[model samples]
Target: MNFVKRAGTSLRARKARTVVLSGIFVVICTLLLGGFLLQAAAARQEADARRTIGVDVTVRGKGLGPAVADRLGRSAPVNRYNPVLPLKAEARGAQPLESDGPKPPGTRTGDRARHFLAVSGVRDSSMLLPFSYGSARITAGRGITPEDSGGQVAVVERRLAERNSLKVGDTVRVRSADHRRTVPLTIVGVFRDPTPDPPRWTPSHELPGNTLYTPVRVAQELGSDAAAVLSEAVFRIGSPEQAERLHAEAERLLGAGTFDFRVNDRAYRDQVRPIQQVGTFAGLIVWVIALAGALILALIVMLQVRERRDELGVLLAMGEKKRKLIGQHLVEVAAVALPAVAVAALAGQLAGQELGDALLDHRQGDVTPGQRQREPVAAGTPRAAVGPPAMDIGPVVLGKVAGIGLGISLVSTAVPGIGILRLHPRSILTHNE
Candidate 1:
């Protein structure tokens, strides 16, 4: 009879053994598949979590030099840079415009006071500090761009514009606090400040209600501080991990004592913590699942070899080569295992998601609120499902599970097959050494 036919005959004759062996594989495949899926989910969570936090850093120190912004801007972690020069601008002939000169002696609380435009020259609308933080929003015209920093272009607050009768394309006269410097500013944009009213203790002159924005170069000229220097450079990083790595590199470049890095990664850290825990658990699960599957399969196969010692002796005595005998045994096991493994693939995927979510939930304590804002995970959308806590079973996940299952099968089969290699036909058939 052909080896394949003989193997089939052997499998059919030992139906009980086949059932037991196949059942073992079914469980093994399920666990492996679940672990793989869970790991994939955790990785995806980590990536999504990082995106929302956004990499923002503020570099502070003395004598930062002009090129510091350029160098830090090109760093691997930086998404962009926002250079700014804040100043108190002087306005003349404008109603309610903050007075530039010192308060007159004995000015009473009920006395009419003036407020100045909180002038800030910025590299770009996007790079400006207050604008980037959403504290001030432009509602009319356009903000001053890089090209307008020193050309007398200005973006004034909407309330400030209303009080001064200023409109887009109109010119307003501004003088420095020393009253010795003055410039003509053309209105280009109007913005609204949504910040809540300051406490009663805060003075009206301190309000940002009548602020102006210009190019950074303009603000520098406006101050004309004999010793003025760029105090700090702010860089928006790309990711939290890169932020940390780049911080070290930046510290070296900027020098430890000369500068300090303030990275904003609180949201990213909180969001990723739970997913990181899941990843750690998944790693351990993989090892345990593979080892457990291998041990059980090997033990069962070893017992099958011992029980068939007499049959093996007969086959060996009948001129069958040891190698061919082993091949037959392998064929028998495969015949039973292949079908069991195929079913296990489906069974494992069905169970992987629910189990994975349970693990995620156990680890998902109070993280950052941003994690909850994750895009709604939908079922049949792609790799994820629409269920609570998000469970996904995709082709990639199944492929990984299948690969791991195949590995376990080979390891379990080969280790026990060694027992047959040690057997001697004469010792078994004649019951003699």
Candidate 2:
């Protein structure tokens, strides 16, 4: 009979032993598959974190104006840019949102007591920290885009809208802080702001609910200066490493040492570092398990060969090639490994979801206590810092597990068979007798 046929017969003859070996193989294969799935998931999450949680570069200088901001924004490294023009304007025929916190001591009672609305003019309202991080969302109409640069438009907070009975398509007039220029802005959109009042006493204009977003041009018109200028402009880059390139570009545009460039990478470090750590950990697990599994199976096969020396001697006496004898042993081990691959694939998929979630949840919270305040937003933002990765068991992972399982089987069988197969047929039979 062929060695393959004889290998099948041997497996059937020792049903109990085969079952025990199969159980061990299943455990080893399951661990290998799980490790691969986790590594793949971590890689995917890291890529997303790089794109969504990018680095923010803030430029501040005396000469940084609308023209310079536009030039820097068009640089190759910048993903998005927002030039802000902040101003204080009096709301005409409308009421600003009130703060629940206590008022400042001895507040003014007459006309001076009324605070001007806090207005923020931007090139793109959606790129602001609040909207990008998702702490704030648009409720109706559209955000103030670049097209509204010179147009008179405004997007108000939902609370401010309710206090003044304002809605989209309604015009609200605002007078400059110097009370020289009065501009009429049509309400383009209304957004919901979850930011709450501070614990300490504060002015109504400084409150979150009283803030307004408008086109940069509107702010420039309402501003006292004839030229359009901004105190600072924010730019987003793909990764923290790209911040250097951006710095160089800014230096080229605005001259080095003249402007203060602040690079904020807190969000990127908080979100991406943990996922990278997890991916590395999973890789270590794969190698350790693969090595240990091969060593264990090799020992088991060695002992089995010693106990079956009589059968090996008899086969050698029958003129069977020693290579065939080794081949038979290898065929049996591989047969057991073949079924374990499928079983492990199923087991891995079932366990990967729970394991992946637990691992990421633990890593995402690995932030230092001191760094919490420095983060762009607090914990309760709409999007999580690092969401759990999807546990997808793709063909690539399956193929890798299968390859490792078979490699383990080959090493286990070959190590023991070579030692015994070297003996002569007469010497092998005499030792058994």
Candidate 3:
């Protein structure tokens, strides 16, 4: 009889053993599949975290103009950059929002009467820390973008806008503190600032509600010189690990002592670390589960071979080749493995998502909201998914599970069955009796 046909007959004849073996294989395969799914999810989550809370390198120094900042931004590590020039300007026609706090000692009635607004010039207002982190948001029109580099456009706070009856398309005039330069900025956007006023007295320009954003060149034009200069430049990189590469680029461009490059990765550390830890843990789980599953299946197969010694001895006496005996055992185990893989794939999908959510929630809870927001976020970047990493069973994961399952089948059947089938037929039959 053909070995394949005999193997099928043997499995049917020992229905109880086949069922038990299939059950064991199902459990092992489920665990192995779960581990593989988790590893894939962790890797995906880590990549998303890196993209969301990218590293921000702030460069502050003298003469850091748009040209210089643009050069630094062109570096391979930089994804995007924003250069800011901060100024305090007297509101020409609009009212500057005042803090609700009580006046401090030595308060000047004249100072209180003066309307000043905090103005910031930027390549892209949307990339500002306040706007990027959700602390402040544009409520109307559009933010100051790169194309508005030289235009006299502004995006003012909504309160400041309401105070002055300002809206998009309206013009707001601001005079440089020196009073020598007054410029009219076309209001292209209005933003909302949720920051509360200081407990004590604060200047009108320093009030959160009185802030304004404009084009970088507009700010420089209002400064002492016609030359463009920046208060500071912030460059964003994909991950904290890329900070070093960015630093090297900065050092090379600025010649090392000309500027101070500071890397702020607090947000990255707080948010991404949890996902990284999960990835590492998942890797360990995959290895442990694979080894343990293989060992368990190997022992079960060994016991099964021992219990069927008489059957194997008779087959050997009937002139069945030793290799065919082993092949028959391998075929039976492989047949069970195929169904076990299918069942495991189904079970893993249902369980893997819950397991992924549980692991992510547990790890993510370690970072508080305050801690996660401590560092400045890169503006205009899409935020990562707020919940658990999506667990998916793709072809790669299925392939890995299938490969490992085959390995387990081979180890479980070949090793122990080979040793038992090596014994002489007479010795095997007498020993069983």
Candidate 4:
């Protein structure tokens, strides 16, 4: 008989068995596909987040000064590192006095005022992040060049510029505690800072605003007492294990007297805690369901063989080869089952994509409340100083999902087929009698 005829006859004779097996295949495929796709997506998202956030080990010491930062910078194990000293200065500018001032004698039309706080002079290795809070884009200017160090040039945040009504090429005055000096900073670039919500003791806004960038040397020049030593160090290691080892080694060498710092691995782990938990749970569920599916399919196929014993005996008696008989049975079951599995897998992928999106959206929204509370509101306004988080999904992530889903389908199907092949037609036929 032709392969199609044999497959059709076998399935028609065992309608109930075919339907049952198909149902099992569908469940197995769905579970496997959904689990793999979601896990892969979660892993990709976690990795991307880690890269964007970066991993850094900060080394600081009360007595170590900036020299320690410089020393660690030369370490071969270090991927990239920069040292910085936090300095405070006042930026003075003239604002047009309100018209009421014109009535007063000797009242200058432009008044000078001072705004104080902290700034930093960081090494070339340390630069502003390219994107933060979507708002921190380079609009209308170049960023601070390495040469700007020790020069009178500064790069201020766009929000800061708008609030102060300052633009590129404007001259502003910066004052150290002991002396007052005016610096003419050409607006080379404006960038948004993607600092996390709630200012965490960093100089810039919790997200990216009201910040300024200038050459490290220029910062030092503004503050004569400014020490040239590095304050913080960032390193990119080959692996998590290497990062851990390097962190420990650096800490040991510096001793407790040096600054306290953290590794990127720790931050990365903490960031993906939720996704990791979800992945673990999904994995467990898939395994349990797939196991049950394999068991059910095997049992259904075995039982169907028993009910077909008379027919199998006749086929054998008619000179039908045992191997052909087995092939026919295999083909019959596979033909019905594989298509069901494929359909279920497609459905599962769609479901997983929707679920993943919802989970991400919910997580992002949940953080908004805490972010608003921690955001620095400009004086006299309830407006949040924080900007929206950056959420960009690239092609690499989609490719990962597709690969994982295909892998799951092959493994889940092949595993059960092995047992199916080992079935003996003669023994099954004899038992049926």
Which candidate leads the pack in TM-score?
A: 3
All models, RMSD in angstroms: 7.7, 5.3, 4.4, 9.0
TM-score of each: 0.68, 0.79, 0.85, 0.61
**Model-by-model lDDT, in order?**
0.65, 0.81, 0.79, 0.52
Ranking by TM-score: 3, 2, 1, 4
Model 2: ten consecutive residues of lowest lDDT? 366-375
Candidate 2 ranges beyond 4 A from true positions: 74-77, 88-117, 124-152, 157-163, 173-184, 191-210, 217-227, 362-385
Cα lDDT tens digits, model 4, 276-303, are: 6766766776677656655565566566
Expressed as tens digits, the lDDT of each residue in 145-204 for candidate 1 is 656645888888777788777889898876765666778878888888876545443334
39-151: candidate 3 lDDT, tens digit per residue: 77877777766655577788988867778898888888887789998877888877787767877888877773448788888987756767666667777998988888868
Error of 3 at 11 (Å): 1.4
Task: Give the local distance difference test score of model 1.
Answer: 0.65
Query: In model 3, what lDDT does residue 152 have?
Result: 92
Better by TM-score, candidate 2 or 1: 2
Give Cα distance to truth, residue 381, candidate 4, Å: 25
Q: Candidate 2 residues 1-433, lDDT tens each?
A: 7999999999999998899889989998899988898899888888766665667789998888888899999998887788988878888888876556666767665443256788988988877767765567789998888898879999999988988889999999998888899999999999988988788766667888888899888888888885766868988787878989989988888898989998877777766787889999999999998999999999988888888887888888898888898898888988999899899988877888998888866343333221121235444422325556888888888899889998999999888978766767788777663
Model 2, position 327: C-alpha lDDT score: 90
TM-score: which is higher, 1 or 4?
1
Clashes of each: 7, 0, 0, 11
